[model samples]
Target: MAAQVLALLRALSGPEAPLEELRALHSALQAVPLGELRERADDLRLGPLFALLGPGSRREQTTLCVSILERLLQAVEPVDVARNFRVDLQKGLAHPSDSVKTLTLSQVGRIVESSDAVTEILNNAELLKQIVYCIGGENLSVAKAAIKSLSRVSLTQTGLEALFESDLLDDLKNVMKTNDIVRYRVYELIVEISSTSPESLNYCTTSGLITELLRELTGEDVLVRATCIEMVTSLAQSHHGRQYLAQEGVIDQISNIIVGAESDPFSSFYLPGFVKFFGNLAVMDSPQQICERYPVFVEKVFEMTESQDPTMVGVAVDTIGILGSTVEGKQVLHKAGTHFEHLLMKVGYQVKNASTELKIRCLDAISSLLYLSPEQETDDLLRMTESWFSSLSRDSLELLRGISNQPFPELRCAALKVFTAMANQPWAQKLMFNSPGFVEYVMDRSVERDKTSKDAKYELVKALANSKTIAEIFGNPNYLRLRAYLSEGPYYVKPVSVTAVEGAE
Candidate 1:
């Protein structure tokens, strides 16, 4: 039965093969019992079944072959099949027929997924070259399948190194430069390949692919730009790629994308990705160079805090936060104190009007910036927070209160963190501590809702720890009752109790 199926597939693969003949072949293969087909899947002649998938040829026969291969792959042990016909299968990857190449590559990926030995067979340098060659082939499906197979086979550092040593990187660059549709497909392959072996950075840089891709950042097509962003992101995963980006001045191009407006409908959708790319680049490049080369870029980002689009505003805030946390970034913000104040005012307003996530991001960025700013900037920071706190609406206050109760430790940490910074100041601390027993009020709330107020209680404890006057006030006999209740609070509360007891003694 397997012999008959193979002969029929061969006959149907020919140009002279009639439609009726192909139909007959399909029926015959489909009629083969599952057990027999599974047995034949283990045979070497299974390699020829791939040739039947011609573009204009027997659709019915092709579908049946696909179904049979899917079954056979599931049922047969790939190691047995790989050992029996590994060379024939590798040759099928480069067959003149697109159908053959596609099916062969798909089966290869499946075989590799099923058994590590199959990958060992495909990992041969010569065989790997054939697979990489198919990536530049005219057949889209075949090229894509080849890429998928390469991703699986190149799991090892040695395999990945061999792939980069091959002409695969050059082939991918050619496809990306020449064909728009294929460009998208192949760029993903490039990302996959580069991600697995960052040592491939040498190949990318030597082949000048990095410069080509950097130019794509400003392409008119959003998808092209998006794919470029993904590739660059993956490439930037390595020290070499990061150093190349800095040496090549790629950040300037990325900054242009961020500051420049697009008239296309989908351009706005890509803006967030652009912003994220810049954020990653900021992390990768030296902060001193970023501040020196892109001073205007920094200013524009500060201005983008006012963007009505929440995504744009959120990304901008994140970028600013990243910058502000860096040393040179701190220097930039410190030098531009007036500009920083204006940006903070806009961010505070956005925190009031933005969505909960956006507001949280805005608050985090502002808090991070203030946390990193110098002591001389403390007065300026406090003045801004005071003005914003005074004007906060009921809705804004409710958001802050809800944020104070967030489940994620980090969000609550950020919220209380800003409050700590604000409350440590002379005027702000006096205002908050003297707000008709505000410290007592917070302590009472912390005790009553100990479960939800871990962060709040923690912050209150630290606030007291840092202030002698606050500690003395809490030590008074009237407040001692509240302090005793806090002693019996949650585990996080006990440490503070121990501290207070130590101080009192």
Candidate 2:
């Protein structure tokens, strides 16, 4: 059996093996038990299989070879594959086909996930170099896969040392110096590895790579800073990353940059990221603390809401939504008092007059502002959300109902989302009952035509039916009507009854 498998693989070693032959080999290998294959691994001569994965191979051959290689790897010891197969795997990475490189990197990702395989992988310096080099390649998909594999390798202490404590660290630096795009890719990889744990983050910090990335955040190049801000935001997603930034005073530095951005001609380019970073910070940490600590961040968010630039307004609106999602965030925004009211007015105007995209964003922000989880349903927060809803206009419910009737499905769904968020509030439910057709609209199955719109309307009815306050607000009869709607799922169409009218052709 070993000799037979070896001869079949040797047949495929050439530039373009016969497609039918490759398929036959793949099927034959599938039937062989992994234990039997492992016993005969030496005679299997897998190098030829890896060769079929390289450039100049037909697509069908490449696909079949990948399948065969996967099965074969499970048979061969992972450590041996990591050690002896290094050169062939590097050839796959160097292959001209992005598909080949991606498929190869995926296998590498699998190998590194096993503890026994990582040391041998880390031992091969050239393989490591090839992976890092791929990060700067032309294909974004290939670059991302390379990034993922390298990040996985750095998950352990030994792997971190190999990447950061060795000459490969210098190689990474040189790659970054090649271009801003390559530099950001490296930055993204570092952020991914560092976010894993305090130990991994410590290695990244000690290497000075994290500091170098922060330096770019304050660099003279607005484009680089803009790109770097996103990476920094990614890093900030992890608690350890956020702690490192705070300890290094990076948050203060970002706020100062926002303050000075008004004078820069390129302010618009980077300011949104700067704002979003703070928005993320506010949610991750304490919203009130962040807003108070950096009043400039909040001020900038509100200012951008009024900007003529759609991008700026969109980010600002999103930030507002984030800040208002939590109880603390709501209090912080409510502390602004009249300023908060003005922002709501702008959002209402946008809902009525802005582009469909912006209008949906405005509705989302309103939904975020009005939402009250059952646990957080304190009297003060409830009143606060009610007041915010009222400030939208004299008749906020009527305005949203108008949006729900719009022909655009997205706007209709967004408008319904806002109602869903409002559904649990007793005050809002009272208003819904008082409004002439609003209750009927919520119950009307024919109102929403598409799946998404139907789902949105069902969610609204479900919220109303499930609310503890529903029976009290709308009498048991109306509440029972909502219950019936809830019993029928989103797509439950009522069966139509047809009776032939007495042969009246």
Candidate 3:
């Protein structure tokens, strides 16, 4: 049915062709399920319709052509769309008809948005030059369409790399220098890049994009500001972006948003992105930079950990890990007693159902806190928690053990590294041997047999093997055997029952 209808439509291309047949074919094409059209698209017949989108085509032919391309782009491989219509699509964008230009640009954006594979074609330097040229075209609708296409193209890796590689940003800056209306389209491109591509995000930070984004952040649009915050979060993904953000007083700007969140609920809504932005900034760059730049950031992050809102809590947990992962950050966390208290508070917070990102954050925060904690607090935490071998209450020891058993190797290793660091400390070693099945949890990492487990178990056993740490539990033969199994060598000792101890006494 499609082939027959398409055939009639193609036959109507002549000047003498019937208008009735043109209307019928246009309606027929729209009525066909996109899937059916895709499955039955005869290139031999449809190719000419695609060609009709170029200059000199009649208005009815061009509109129908755009409609067909729209459907095909949705259902077919975007790479195929680029291949079949690349020449015509480019021509349509350059056509005398603004409608043709607009429709072609919209469809091109659709292709770029949907197919990760078609970026290579869209990235063609010459093709991109044409698209960029159209971005400043006199027709307002045409230029907006070009901007929308550029935004979509900026969403993927190849398209983004091309945009970053090309002179597009320079051109965009020049265009926006005098053109206020075009700047909104530029804002769309920036926000789209900030939201979607980390590579693009990093590039935007240095290529005058951070300056533009910061400038536009003064605008009244909530989305632009929200997306600007989002761009900061993306900048957090790379070292360059973070340093640029910090050096340029973006933190001060961000704090204004965070501080302003107190009054405006709508403004407050964007706090998660701010949370992530600050969190990422905390880790990749200097701790001194984060601390010196944002003096109250640690306290802000701590308050968030205890929030009733789970998203705030999750981002806060991640922020804490990054903030405390460094020596300076850890020292800052340790000096402020409440930071560790709040961090330990999250240990048992929905441990079983937490997302992997949250779980990793939990492991990291606990590990860093353990590393920075004073000897007395560390011992108290271990002893009191070890005393709860049979209790329902949450404590740091159980948190460590639970994190060790989690499915993520990175989480397990992070937990174990802290334990290994503390194994030489009496407090940590005592809990390892006496906290009920803790030794087995350390050695029997058959739960996950990956290389990290083997390596972690080796380091842990070597730490626990110290005779000084094992002496207290040697009176229990079960402890002796478990220690022997883990520690190896002359440390191998047999179990003695209670009766034997009684006999000795």
Candidate 4:
């Protein structure tokens, strides 16, 4: 069996190894006992597996190598695997094939996930160097994987020390020196590591990479600033990260950038990120406070809503949806009064006139704005969303109802989701009850054929049935019908009686 395994490895390493041979190798390796495989791990010469994953390898071959490698690596201690395959893995990282580098990074990622593997890779300066070098590779996938692996490594204290404090930090700096594209890739890795924990963030801060990245946020390079905006947004996802940004006045720096963005001709390049960063910041923290501190963010959002560019409109609409979803956020927009009113009208107009993709986004934004979870549904917020919904158009329900009847399934489902979001609201419920055939539409499962549409219809029915205000607004008969629809479930089909079927056959 060992000889057979060795033979198969040799065959697989061949330039033209047949697919059958690959399959056979996979099956034979699976049949090998774990203990035996471990004992023979060295003799197995797994180096060829990495070669088989090189460029032009068939999908099945690549997948087979990954599976086999995962099983083998899991059976043995990661330290031994690293010790034995260190040179091969390093070569794979430097291999001309992006396939080779990605596959190698995948293994390194696996190794780092285990506590025992960290030290060996950390101690191997050459191995660490190779991994860091991959971050600056031309291949985006390879660079992302390399960043992912290194980020996993930095999850530990020792890994953090090795990356930020040791000579390997110099390697990372060298990698960043390659170009702006490569430089941002390294910055991305630093942000990722920093996002993990306070201590990890401290390490990153001490290394001065975070400061450097923020400097570029206000830097002259439009492209680099655009890239940095995205990275900083990611950093802001964490509590500590957001606090760090605010305390460091990076939030103000980003706000200043957004204000200045309109004057920059290349503003189009980075404007979306700038808007999205504020959108994210608003929801993550206090919508009112962030908007107040950076009124330009809100001004830009509204300006974007009115832009002719679909991209700008989409981001603005999305930000509005996000801000409107929360109670505090809803109040902030509600206080804007007519500006908010005008924005809702704009979204409705988009739903009617925009492209299918934009229509879906409009519907999503509407859903987010109107939706209030059972816990969060206070009288004021409900009235606020209702007021916003009413302000959408004199016949807001009719607009979405017409959209619900569209041929496009995605558009139709998105419209139904908007209904689901507003189903519990007293005003929305009354409007539905008053609208002809609206209750029937909600009850008719037959209208929705596809699984997505079916699930969406079920959700709407469920929302209506569960609403505390629904029964009172809809009255008992219609309410009972909603409950019946809910009882039947999402995919229920009505049974047809066929007494004479056997005779007819």
Task: For each candidate in the order shown, give its overall lDDT on alpha carbons.
Answer: 0.61, 0.87, 0.63, 0.85
Give a tens-digit lDDT track for model 2, residues 198-241. Answer: 89999888889889999989988998888999999999999988
- Cα lDDT for residue 248, candidate 2: 94
lDDT of 4 by residue, 242-272 (tens): 9999899988887888888767888988899
Candidate 1 whole-model C-alpha lDDT, 0 to 1: 0.61
All models, RMSD in angstroms: 11.5, 3.4, 12.8, 3.6
Look at candidate 3 and give me any clashing residue pairs. none
lDDT of 3 at 323: 66
What TM-score should be assigned to candidate 3? 0.50
The residue pairs found clashing in candidate 1 are none
* Best candidate, TM-score: 2
What TM-score fits each model? 0.56, 0.90, 0.50, 0.89
lDDT of 1 by residue, 420-452 (tens): 655444554556545555565456544334444
Using lDDT as the measure, the top candidate is: 2
What is the overall TM-score of model 4 with all chains considered together? 0.89
TM-score for predicted model 2 compared with the true structure: 0.90
Q: Which candidate would rank higher by TM-score, 2 or 4? A: 2
Per-residue lDDT, model 2, residue 490, is 93
Kindly report which residue stretches of model 4 are placed more than 4 angstroms away from their true locations once superposed: 1-77, 501-505
Error of 1 at 154 (Å): 5.6
Model 3 lowest lDDT segment of ten = 384-393
| CA lDDT, candidate 3, residue 463 | 60
Worst 10 residues of 1 by lDDT: 490-499
- Candidates sorted by lDDT, descending order? 2, 4, 3, 1
The alpha-carbon deviation from the true structure for residue 315 of candidate 2, after best TM-score superposition, in angstroms, is: 0.9
